[model samples]
Target: MPHLHDDALTLLALGEAPTDEESAHLDLCPRCRADLGSFRRVVTAARQAGAEEPGTAAAADSDNPGLQSPGPDVWARIHRELNLDDALRNDPLASPNAFAADAFDPARPSPAAHAGTPQGNVRPLAAARHRRTGAWLAAAAAAVVVAGAGTWATLRAVDPVPGPEVVASAELSPLPAYSDTGSAVVDRLPDGRRELVVTSTGDDAQGYREVWLLAPDATSMVSLGTMEGTEAHFELPADLDLSRYPVVDVSDEPYDGDPAHSGDSILRGELDL
Candidate 1:
Protein backbone atom coordinates (compact mmCIF):
# COMPACT_ATOMS: atom_id res chain seq x y z
CA MET A 1 0.00 0.00 0.00
CA PRO A 2 1.22 3.55 -0.85
CA HIS A 3 1.04 6.50 1.53
CA LEU A 4 -1.48 9.24 0.63
CA HIS A 5 -0.58 12.97 0.61
CA ASP A 6 -2.33 16.26 -0.29
CA ASP A 7 -0.44 16.38 -3.59
CA ALA A 8 -2.33 13.31 -4.79
CA LEU A 9 -5.32 15.66 -4.99
CA THR A 10 -3.49 17.89 -7.49
CA LEU A 11 -2.58 14.90 -9.64
CA LEU A 12 -6.22 13.85 -9.66
CA ALA A 13 -7.23 17.39 -10.60
CA LEU A 14 -4.82 17.09 -13.53
CA GLY A 15 -6.70 13.88 -14.50
CA GLU A 16 -3.71 11.71 -13.68
CA ALA A 17 -5.11 9.02 -11.39
CA PRO A 18 -3.00 5.92 -11.91
CA THR A 19 -4.96 3.17 -13.65
CA ASP A 20 -3.70 -0.14 -12.17
CA GLU A 21 -1.06 0.27 -9.47
CA GLU A 22 -2.13 3.68 -8.17
CA SER A 23 -5.77 2.74 -8.52
CA ALA A 24 -5.24 -0.09 -6.01
CA HIS A 25 -3.34 2.40 -3.83
CA LEU A 26 -6.25 4.91 -4.00
CA ASP A 27 -8.71 2.11 -3.14
CA LEU A 28 -6.81 1.36 0.01
CA CYS A 29 -6.14 5.07 0.87
CA PRO A 30 -9.44 6.83 1.68
CA ARG A 31 -7.57 9.98 2.83
CA CYS A 32 -5.98 10.57 -0.62
CA ARG A 33 -9.27 9.95 -2.46
CA ALA A 34 -11.11 12.54 -0.36
CA ASP A 35 -8.23 15.04 -0.74
CA LEU A 36 -8.21 14.46 -4.51
CA GLY A 37 -11.85 15.54 -4.81
CA SER A 38 -11.17 18.70 -2.74
CA PHE A 39 -8.11 19.47 -4.92
CA ARG A 40 -10.26 19.26 -8.04
CA ARG A 41 -12.79 21.73 -6.61
CA VAL A 42 -10.10 24.20 -5.47
CA VAL A 43 -8.31 24.09 -8.82
CA THR A 44 -11.57 24.67 -10.67
CA ALA A 45 -12.41 27.67 -8.50
CA ALA A 46 -8.91 29.11 -8.88
CA ARG A 47 -9.03 28.77 -12.63
CA GLN A 48 -12.41 30.46 -12.82
CA ALA A 49 -11.33 33.27 -10.50
CA GLY A 50 -7.99 34.37 -11.94
CA ALA A 51 -5.71 31.71 -13.40
CA GLU A 52 -8.30 31.16 -16.21
CA GLU A 53 -6.46 28.01 -17.34
CA PRO A 54 -5.06 25.02 -15.54
CA GLY A 55 -2.73 23.21 -17.94
CA THR A 56 -0.15 24.84 -20.22
CA ALA A 57 -1.80 23.54 -23.42
CA ALA A 58 -4.32 26.34 -24.14
CA ALA A 59 -2.41 29.23 -22.58
CA ALA A 60 -0.88 32.00 -24.68
CA ASP A 61 2.44 30.96 -26.20
CA SER A 62 5.00 33.72 -26.93
CA ASP A 63 5.79 32.49 -30.46
CA ASN A 64 2.60 33.71 -32.25
CA PRO A 65 2.65 37.22 -30.78
CA GLY A 66 4.76 38.69 -33.60
CA LEU A 67 7.58 38.82 -31.07
CA GLN A 68 10.50 36.71 -30.01
CA SER A 69 9.98 34.13 -27.34
CA PRO A 70 10.59 35.62 -23.89
CA GLY A 71 13.28 34.35 -21.58
CA PRO A 72 12.60 31.21 -19.53
CA ASP A 73 11.92 33.39 -16.45
CA VAL A 74 9.02 35.17 -18.15
CA TRP A 75 6.49 33.27 -16.08
CA ALA A 76 7.68 34.85 -12.83
CA ARG A 77 4.58 37.00 -12.71
CA ILE A 78 2.30 33.99 -12.99
CA HIS A 79 4.21 32.18 -10.28
CA ARG A 80 3.82 35.07 -7.83
CA GLU A 81 0.15 35.54 -8.72
CA LEU A 82 -0.72 31.88 -8.15
CA ASN A 83 0.60 31.81 -4.54
CA LEU A 84 2.29 28.42 -5.01
CA ASP A 85 4.59 28.76 -1.98
CA ASP A 86 3.30 25.73 -0.07
CA ALA A 87 3.05 23.66 -3.22
CA LEU A 88 6.58 24.66 -4.27
CA ARG A 89 7.95 23.72 -0.86
CA ASN A 90 6.13 20.40 -0.62
CA ASP A 91 7.07 19.44 -4.19
CA PRO A 92 9.57 16.56 -4.28
CA LEU A 93 10.73 17.58 -7.75
CA ALA A 94 11.55 21.16 -6.66
CA SER A 95 14.88 22.26 -5.19
CA PRO A 96 15.47 21.50 -1.53
CA ASN A 97 13.60 23.88 0.79
CA ALA A 98 16.50 25.70 2.50
CA PHE A 99 14.21 28.44 3.84
CA ALA A 100 11.30 26.19 4.77
CA ALA A 101 10.69 28.13 8.00
CA ASP A 102 10.89 31.63 6.51
CA ALA A 103 9.30 30.97 3.12
CA PHE A 104 6.05 32.46 4.40
CA ASP A 105 7.57 35.86 5.15
CA PRO A 106 11.11 35.84 3.79
CA ALA A 107 13.26 38.15 5.96
CA ARG A 108 11.14 41.28 6.03
CA PRO A 109 12.74 44.40 7.61
CA SER A 110 11.49 46.07 10.78
CA PRO A 111 10.64 49.61 9.80
CA ALA A 112 11.03 50.92 13.36
CA ALA A 113 14.55 49.56 13.90
CA HIS A 114 17.13 50.99 11.53
CA ALA A 115 19.87 52.12 14.00
CA GLY A 116 21.61 48.77 14.54
CA THR A 117 21.56 47.70 10.89
CA PRO A 118 24.43 49.41 9.08
CA GLN A 119 23.70 50.79 5.64
CA GLY A 120 24.66 47.39 4.26
CA ASN A 121 22.40 45.53 6.68
CA VAL A 122 19.80 48.27 6.64
CA ARG A 123 18.82 47.27 3.10
CA PRO A 124 15.49 45.46 3.21
CA LEU A 125 15.63 42.04 1.52
CA ALA A 126 11.89 42.19 0.84
CA ALA A 127 12.29 45.60 -0.73
CA ALA A 128 15.18 44.18 -2.74
CA ARG A 129 12.87 41.42 -3.98
CA HIS A 130 10.26 43.93 -5.03
CA ARG A 131 12.97 46.05 -6.61
CA ARG A 132 14.27 43.07 -8.54
CA THR A 133 10.72 42.31 -9.66
CA GLY A 134 10.29 45.87 -10.89
CA ALA A 135 13.63 45.77 -12.66
CA TRP A 136 12.68 42.54 -14.40
CA LEU A 137 9.42 44.09 -15.56
CA ALA A 138 11.28 47.15 -16.86
CA ALA A 139 13.82 44.96 -18.61
CA ALA A 140 11.08 42.95 -20.24
CA ALA A 141 9.48 46.12 -21.54
CA ALA A 142 12.83 47.38 -22.85
CA ALA A 143 13.44 44.05 -24.53
CA VAL A 144 10.11 44.29 -26.29
CA VAL A 145 10.94 47.76 -27.57
CA VAL A 146 14.40 46.67 -28.62
CA ALA A 147 13.07 43.60 -30.38
CA GLY A 148 10.55 45.71 -32.27
CA ALA A 149 13.26 48.17 -33.25
CA GLY A 150 15.59 45.40 -34.38
CA THR A 151 12.87 43.94 -36.60
CA TRP A 152 12.15 47.31 -38.12
CA ALA A 153 15.84 47.93 -38.75
CA THR A 154 16.21 44.55 -40.47
CA LEU A 155 13.26 45.22 -42.76
CA ARG A 156 14.52 48.68 -43.63
CA ALA A 157 18.02 47.39 -44.26
CA VAL A 158 16.76 44.74 -46.72
CA ASP A 159 14.22 46.89 -48.57
CA PRO A 160 15.18 47.75 -52.14
CA VAL A 161 15.42 51.40 -53.16
CA PRO A 162 14.29 52.83 -56.53
CA GLY A 163 17.42 53.14 -58.70
CA PRO A 164 19.08 52.01 -61.94
CA GLU A 165 19.90 48.32 -62.48
CA VAL A 166 22.58 48.40 -65.20
CA VAL A 167 26.11 47.22 -64.27
CA ALA A 168 29.37 47.09 -66.38
CA SER A 169 29.87 44.32 -68.90
CA ALA A 170 33.15 42.37 -69.00
CA GLU A 171 33.11 41.02 -72.60
CA LEU A 172 35.46 42.95 -74.87
CA SER A 173 33.96 44.58 -77.98
CA PRO A 174 33.12 42.09 -80.79
CA LEU A 175 35.46 44.00 -83.11
CA PRO A 176 39.13 44.03 -82.13
CA ALA A 177 39.36 47.40 -83.89
CA TYR A 178 37.43 48.98 -81.05
CA SER A 179 39.93 50.65 -78.65
CA ASP A 180 37.95 51.43 -75.50
CA THR A 181 39.81 53.22 -72.67
CA GLY A 182 37.53 53.30 -69.63
CA SER A 183 38.30 55.43 -66.58
CA ALA A 184 35.96 55.76 -63.58
CA VAL A 185 36.34 58.87 -61.36
CA VAL A 186 34.68 59.75 -58.01
CA ASP A 187 34.59 63.40 -56.76
CA ARG A 188 33.01 65.19 -53.81
CA LEU A 189 31.16 68.19 -55.14
CA PRO A 190 31.40 71.62 -53.42
CA ASP A 191 27.91 71.17 -51.93
CA GLY A 192 28.91 68.07 -49.93
CA ARG A 193 27.19 65.84 -52.57
CA ARG A 194 29.00 63.11 -54.58
CA GLU A 195 29.60 62.76 -58.38
CA LEU A 196 30.65 59.70 -60.39
CA VAL A 197 32.30 60.23 -63.82
CA VAL A 198 32.83 57.20 -66.10
CA THR A 199 34.72 58.31 -69.21
CA SER A 200 35.08 55.78 -72.05
CA THR A 201 37.26 57.31 -74.79
CA GLY A 202 37.67 54.96 -77.76
CA ASP A 203 37.15 54.85 -81.51
CA ASP A 204 34.15 52.47 -81.42
CA ALA A 205 33.23 52.85 -77.75
CA GLN A 206 32.77 56.65 -77.48
CA GLY A 207 29.34 56.19 -75.91
CA TYR A 208 27.59 56.07 -72.53
CA ARG A 209 28.47 53.47 -69.86
CA GLU A 210 26.13 52.45 -67.06
CA VAL A 211 27.13 53.89 -63.70
CA TRP A 212 26.39 52.27 -60.37
CA LEU A 213 26.92 53.25 -56.73
CA LEU A 214 27.56 50.05 -54.80
CA ALA A 215 27.66 49.44 -51.10
CA PRO A 216 31.08 48.84 -49.58
CA ASP A 217 30.60 45.10 -49.47
CA ALA A 218 29.50 45.09 -53.19
CA THR A 219 26.49 43.06 -52.20
CA SER A 220 24.14 45.76 -53.56
CA MET A 221 24.57 48.33 -56.36
CA VAL A 222 22.23 51.16 -57.42
CA SER A 223 22.19 52.49 -60.99
CA LEU A 224 22.89 56.20 -61.64
CA GLY A 225 21.87 56.42 -65.30
CA THR A 226 24.19 56.56 -68.35
CA MET A 227 27.32 58.76 -68.57
CA GLU A 228 27.95 59.44 -72.25
CA GLY A 229 31.28 60.71 -73.61
CA THR A 230 29.59 63.99 -74.63
CA GLU A 231 28.12 64.66 -71.19
CA ALA A 232 30.68 66.39 -68.92
CA HIS A 233 28.82 66.59 -65.58
CA PHE A 234 26.60 64.10 -63.68
CA GLU A 235 25.17 65.18 -60.36
CA LEU A 236 24.33 63.06 -57.29
CA PRO A 237 21.16 63.80 -55.39
CA ALA A 238 21.54 66.17 -52.44
CA ASP A 239 19.65 63.69 -50.34
CA LEU A 240 22.38 61.13 -51.10
CA ASP A 241 25.43 62.13 -49.02
CA LEU A 242 28.93 60.67 -49.18
CA SER A 243 28.58 58.96 -45.81
CA ARG A 244 25.75 56.85 -47.26
CA TYR A 245 27.07 56.10 -50.78
CA PRO A 246 30.75 55.15 -50.55
CA VAL A 247 31.50 53.06 -53.67
CA VAL A 248 31.04 53.73 -57.45
CA ASP A 249 31.50 51.53 -60.53
CA VAL A 250 31.41 52.02 -64.31
CA SER A 251 30.34 49.37 -66.86
CA ASP A 252 29.80 49.04 -70.62
CA GLU A 253 26.20 49.64 -71.71
CA PRO A 254 24.46 48.65 -74.99
CA TYR A 255 22.25 51.82 -74.95
CA ASP A 256 19.28 49.54 -75.79
CA GLY A 257 17.16 51.38 -73.15
CA ASP A 258 16.89 48.18 -71.07
CA PRO A 259 17.57 49.26 -67.47
CA ALA A 260 19.15 46.02 -66.23
CA HIS A 261 22.91 45.49 -66.52
CA SER A 262 24.26 42.99 -69.11
CA GLY A 263 26.41 41.25 -66.43
CA ASP A 264 29.59 42.11 -68.40
CA SER A 265 31.90 44.16 -66.16
CA ILE A 266 35.02 45.88 -67.55
CA LEU A 267 36.20 48.36 -64.84
CA ARG A 268 35.15 48.86 -61.21
CA GLY A 269 36.46 51.37 -58.61
CA GLU A 270 35.37 52.56 -55.14
CA LEU A 271 35.69 56.09 -53.69
CA ASP A 272 38.76 56.96 -51.56
CA LEU A 273 36.95 58.65 -48.66
Candidate 2:
Protein backbone atom coordinates (compact mmCIF):
# COMPACT_ATOMS: atom_id res chain seq x y z
CA MET A 1 0.00 0.00 0.00
CA PRO A 2 1.15 3.55 -0.68
CA HIS A 3 2.29 5.27 2.48
CA LEU A 4 -0.37 7.45 4.03
CA HIS A 5 2.17 9.93 5.26
CA ASP A 6 2.08 12.68 7.86
CA ASP A 7 0.71 15.31 5.50
CA ALA A 8 -2.54 13.43 5.53
CA LEU A 9 -2.51 13.34 9.33
CA THR A 10 -1.89 17.09 9.34
CA LEU A 11 -5.13 17.52 7.47
CA LEU A 12 -6.90 15.38 10.01
CA ALA A 13 -5.42 17.16 13.00
CA LEU A 14 -6.61 20.45 11.60
CA GLY A 15 -10.19 19.14 12.15
CA GLU A 16 -10.56 18.08 8.56
CA ALA A 17 -10.80 14.38 9.27
CA PRO A 18 -11.32 12.32 6.17
CA THR A 19 -14.85 12.03 4.83
CA ASP A 20 -16.92 8.91 5.33
CA GLU A 21 -15.56 7.16 2.25
CA GLU A 22 -11.90 7.89 3.04
CA SER A 23 -12.33 7.22 6.73
CA ALA A 24 -13.45 3.67 5.91
CA HIS A 25 -10.27 3.03 3.95
CA LEU A 26 -8.10 4.46 6.70
CA ASP A 27 -9.84 2.36 9.32
CA LEU A 28 -9.14 -0.74 7.30
CA CYS A 29 -5.47 0.07 6.76
CA PRO A 30 -3.09 -0.35 9.70
CA ARG A 31 -0.15 1.40 8.09
CA CYS A 32 -2.18 4.46 7.26
CA ARG A 33 -3.53 4.62 10.80
CA ALA A 34 -0.05 4.30 12.23
CA ASP A 35 1.22 7.15 10.10
CA LEU A 36 -1.77 9.28 11.03
CA GLY A 37 -1.22 8.57 14.72
CA SER A 38 2.35 9.75 14.58
CA PHE A 39 1.39 13.03 12.94
CA ARG A 40 -1.49 13.53 15.35
CA ARG A 41 0.84 12.95 18.29
CA VAL A 42 3.18 15.61 16.98
CA VAL A 43 0.37 18.12 16.46
CA THR A 44 -1.13 17.40 19.83
CA ALA A 45 2.23 17.74 21.50
CA ALA A 46 2.81 21.09 19.82
CA ARG A 47 -0.54 22.35 20.97
CA GLN A 48 0.04 21.13 24.50
CA ALA A 49 3.26 23.12 24.75
CA GLY A 50 1.54 26.34 23.68
CA ALA A 51 -1.46 25.89 25.93
CA GLU A 52 0.35 26.97 29.04
CA GLU A 53 -2.71 28.59 30.56
CA PRO A 54 -5.62 26.44 31.64
CA GLY A 55 -8.15 27.92 29.25
CA THR A 56 -5.94 27.85 26.12
CA ALA A 57 -7.28 24.50 25.08
CA ALA A 58 -10.81 25.88 24.96
CA ALA A 59 -9.59 28.90 23.07
CA ALA A 60 -7.67 26.81 20.55
CA ASP A 61 -10.66 24.62 19.97
CA SER A 62 -12.88 27.63 19.41
CA ASP A 63 -10.54 29.42 17.05
CA ASN A 64 -11.41 29.00 13.40
CA PRO A 65 -8.77 27.07 11.49
CA GLY A 66 -9.18 29.50 8.56
CA LEU A 67 -8.97 32.68 10.60
CA GLN A 68 -5.80 34.60 11.35
CA SER A 69 -5.05 33.83 14.96
CA PRO A 70 -2.01 34.58 17.05
CA GLY A 71 -0.28 31.22 17.22
CA PRO A 72 2.26 30.04 19.75
CA ASP A 73 5.58 31.85 19.84
CA VAL A 74 7.97 30.36 17.36
CA TRP A 75 10.22 28.79 19.99
CA ALA A 76 7.30 27.25 21.84
CA ARG A 77 5.97 25.86 18.59
CA ILE A 78 9.37 24.44 17.66
CA HIS A 79 9.72 22.58 20.94
CA ARG A 80 6.37 20.96 20.38
CA GLU A 81 6.97 20.37 16.70
CA LEU A 82 10.26 18.66 17.39
CA ASN A 83 8.95 16.63 20.34
CA LEU A 84 11.55 18.53 22.34
CA ASP A 85 9.18 19.20 25.20
CA ASP A 86 10.96 16.81 27.52
CA ALA A 87 14.39 18.02 26.42
CA LEU A 88 13.53 21.71 26.58
CA ARG A 89 11.69 21.38 29.87
CA ASN A 90 14.75 19.73 31.35
CA ASP A 91 17.34 21.65 29.34
CA PRO A 92 19.18 24.86 30.07
CA LEU A 93 18.36 25.95 26.55
CA ALA A 94 14.56 26.05 26.49
CA SER A 95 13.61 26.46 22.84
CA PRO A 96 15.94 27.68 20.16
CA ASN A 97 19.35 26.09 20.72
CA ALA A 98 21.27 28.78 18.86
CA PHE A 99 24.13 30.59 20.58
CA ALA A 100 24.22 34.36 20.77
CA ALA A 101 27.44 36.35 20.21
CA ASP A 102 27.84 37.53 23.79
CA ALA A 103 27.11 34.16 25.38
CA PHE A 104 30.67 32.89 25.10
CA ASP A 105 32.94 32.75 28.13
CA PRO A 106 31.13 35.29 30.28
CA ALA A 107 33.58 34.73 33.11
CA ARG A 108 36.60 35.27 30.91
CA PRO A 109 38.16 38.67 31.51
CA SER A 110 38.89 40.86 28.52
CA PRO A 111 41.98 43.08 28.04
CA ALA A 112 39.72 46.07 27.57
CA ALA A 113 37.99 45.27 30.86
CA HIS A 114 38.99 48.57 32.40
CA ALA A 115 39.27 50.64 29.23
CA GLY A 116 36.24 52.72 30.14
CA THR A 117 37.68 53.66 33.54
CA PRO A 118 39.88 56.60 34.61
CA GLN A 119 43.28 56.12 36.28
CA GLY A 120 44.16 56.13 40.03
CA ASN A 121 40.83 57.20 41.49
CA VAL A 122 39.03 54.64 43.69
CA ARG A 123 35.62 55.97 42.62
CA PRO A 124 36.59 55.59 38.95
CA LEU A 125 37.65 52.02 39.54
CA ALA A 126 34.46 51.21 41.45
CA ALA A 127 32.26 52.98 38.93
CA ALA A 128 34.04 51.35 36.04
CA ARG A 129 33.67 47.95 37.64
CA HIS A 130 29.96 48.53 38.07
CA ARG A 131 29.66 49.70 34.50
CA ARG A 132 31.55 46.68 33.26
CA THR A 133 29.38 44.39 35.28
CA GLY A 134 26.30 46.13 33.97
CA ALA A 135 27.54 45.86 30.43
CA TRP A 136 28.13 42.17 30.85
CA LEU A 137 24.71 41.73 32.37
CA ALA A 138 23.08 43.60 29.51
CA ALA A 139 25.00 41.56 27.01
CA ALA A 140 24.00 38.37 28.74
CA ALA A 141 20.37 39.37 28.72
CA ALA A 142 20.54 40.27 25.04
CA ALA A 143 22.21 36.95 24.36
CA VAL A 144 19.42 35.06 26.06
CA VAL A 145 16.80 36.85 24.05
CA VAL A 146 18.70 36.42 20.86
CA ALA A 147 19.30 32.76 21.55
CA GLY A 148 15.64 32.21 22.19
CA ALA A 149 14.54 34.26 19.20
CA GLY A 150 17.20 32.80 16.97
CA THR A 151 16.22 29.24 17.83
CA TRP A 152 12.62 30.04 17.08
CA ALA A 153 13.40 31.64 13.73
CA THR A 154 15.87 28.95 12.73
CA LEU A 155 13.57 26.06 13.64
CA ARG A 156 10.67 27.84 12.00
CA ALA A 157 12.55 28.32 8.76
CA VAL A 158 14.01 24.83 8.93
CA ASP A 159 10.76 23.23 10.14
CA PRO A 160 12.44 20.87 12.60
CA VAL A 161 9.32 18.80 13.11
CA PRO A 162 9.47 15.25 11.78
CA GLY A 163 7.49 14.54 8.66
CA PRO A 164 7.80 12.99 5.21
CA GLU A 165 10.87 15.11 4.56
CA VAL A 166 13.86 14.03 2.49
CA VAL A 167 16.93 13.30 4.61
CA ALA A 168 20.66 13.13 3.81
CA SER A 169 23.03 11.47 6.26
CA ALA A 170 26.44 9.77 6.30
CA GLU A 171 28.03 6.94 8.23
CA LEU A 172 30.36 7.51 11.16
CA SER A 173 32.13 4.22 11.51
CA PRO A 174 33.93 3.19 14.71
CA LEU A 175 31.88 5.20 17.15
CA PRO A 176 33.34 5.69 20.60
CA ALA A 177 31.65 3.98 23.50
CA TYR A 178 29.84 7.22 24.20
CA SER A 179 30.60 9.91 21.67
CA ASP A 180 28.30 12.71 20.59
CA THR A 181 30.24 13.46 17.40
CA GLY A 182 29.51 10.04 15.98
CA SER A 183 25.79 10.65 15.92
CA ALA A 184 23.51 12.43 13.50
CA VAL A 185 20.90 14.75 14.99
CA VAL A 186 17.71 15.77 13.28
CA ASP A 187 15.73 18.51 14.96
CA ARG A 188 11.96 18.53 14.90
CA LEU A 189 10.23 21.77 13.85
CA PRO A 190 6.99 23.28 15.08
CA ASP A 191 5.25 22.33 11.87
CA GLY A 192 6.09 18.64 12.42
CA ARG A 193 8.88 18.62 9.80
CA ARG A 194 12.42 17.47 10.57
CA GLU A 195 15.90 18.85 9.86
CA LEU A 196 18.69 16.30 9.58
CA VAL A 197 22.18 17.60 10.40
CA VAL A 198 24.62 14.92 9.32
CA THR A 199 28.40 15.18 9.75
CA SER A 200 31.25 13.20 8.23
CA THR A 201 34.84 13.79 7.14
CA GLY A 202 35.30 13.70 3.34
CA ASP A 203 39.09 13.63 3.07
CA ASP A 204 39.18 10.15 1.51
CA ALA A 205 40.60 9.88 -2.01
CA GLN A 206 37.17 8.73 -3.13
CA GLY A 207 35.09 11.81 -3.94
CA TYR A 208 31.66 10.52 -2.84
CA ARG A 209 30.13 9.63 0.53
CA GLU A 210 27.88 6.56 0.66
CA VAL A 211 24.94 6.90 3.06
CA TRP A 212 22.73 4.07 4.19
CA LEU A 213 19.75 3.48 6.43
CA LEU A 214 20.32 0.43 8.60
CA ALA A 215 17.18 -1.57 9.07
CA PRO A 216 16.13 -2.06 12.67
CA ASP A 217 17.27 -5.65 12.68
CA ALA A 218 20.69 -4.48 11.49
CA THR A 219 20.53 -7.21 8.90
CA SER A 220 19.48 -5.24 5.82
CA MET A 221 20.33 -1.78 4.49
CA VAL A 222 18.56 0.83 2.41
CA SER A 223 20.46 3.52 0.56
CA LEU A 224 19.93 7.18 1.28
CA GLY A 225 21.48 9.51 -1.32
CA THR A 226 25.26 9.93 -1.33
CA MET A 227 26.89 13.16 -0.20
CA GLU A 228 30.32 14.80 -0.76
CA GLY A 229 30.79 17.42 1.96
CA THR A 230 32.07 17.17 5.53
CA GLU A 231 28.73 18.41 6.83
CA ALA A 232 25.42 17.88 5.13
CA HIS A 233 21.85 18.72 6.12
CA PHE A 234 18.90 16.92 4.61
CA GLU A 235 15.19 16.70 5.27
CA LEU A 236 14.15 13.15 6.13
CA PRO A 237 11.05 11.57 4.75
CA ALA A 238 8.22 12.35 7.18
CA ASP A 239 6.94 8.79 7.24
CA LEU A 240 10.28 7.33 8.25
CA ASP A 241 9.99 4.72 11.00
CA LEU A 242 12.20 6.05 13.73
CA SER A 243 11.61 2.99 15.88
CA ARG A 244 12.62 0.63 13.12
CA TYR A 245 15.70 2.04 11.39
CA PRO A 246 17.46 3.91 14.15
CA VAL A 247 20.94 3.89 12.67
CA VAL A 248 22.66 5.52 9.67
CA ASP A 249 25.90 4.45 8.04
CA VAL A 250 28.26 6.54 5.95
CA SER A 251 30.80 4.91 3.65
CA ASP A 252 33.15 5.96 0.89
CA GLU A 253 31.74 5.23 -2.55
CA PRO A 254 33.54 5.17 -5.89
CA TYR A 255 32.23 7.10 -8.88
CA ASP A 256 30.27 4.13 -10.18
CA GLY A 257 26.50 3.63 -9.85
CA ASP A 258 26.83 -0.06 -8.95
CA PRO A 259 24.63 -1.10 -6.02
CA ALA A 260 26.95 -3.76 -4.58
CA HIS A 261 28.73 -3.11 -1.31
CA SER A 262 31.98 -1.15 -1.74
CA GLY A 263 33.65 -3.01 1.17
CA ASP A 264 35.48 0.26 1.92
CA SER A 265 33.16 1.39 4.69
CA ILE A 266 34.60 4.31 6.62
CA LEU A 267 31.86 5.56 8.95
CA ARG A 268 28.87 4.06 10.68
CA GLY A 269 26.81 5.71 13.39
CA GLU A 270 23.40 5.77 15.01
CA LEU A 271 20.80 8.50 15.11
CA ASP A 272 19.63 9.52 18.58
CA LEU A 273 15.98 9.08 17.84
Clashing pairs for model 1 are: 168-251, 168-264, 169-264, 169-265, 170-264, 170-265
Q: How many Å off is the CA of 23 in candidate 2?
A: 52
lDDT of 2 at 224: 70
Each candidate: what lDDT? 0.42, 0.46
Residue-level lDDT tens digits of model 1 in 113-198: 34455444544443332322333232222222222222223211222122221121111222233445443444453355545545
Off by over 4 Å in 1: 1-182, 191-193, 203-208, 241-245, 255-257
What are the per-residue Cα lDDT tens digits for candidate 2 across 101-164? 2222233333344565333322422122223332223222222323323344422232214544
Q: Model 2: runs farther than 4 Å from truth?
A: 1-171, 175-182, 205-207
User: TM-score, each model?
Assistant: 0.29, 0.36
Best-matching candidate per lDDT: 2
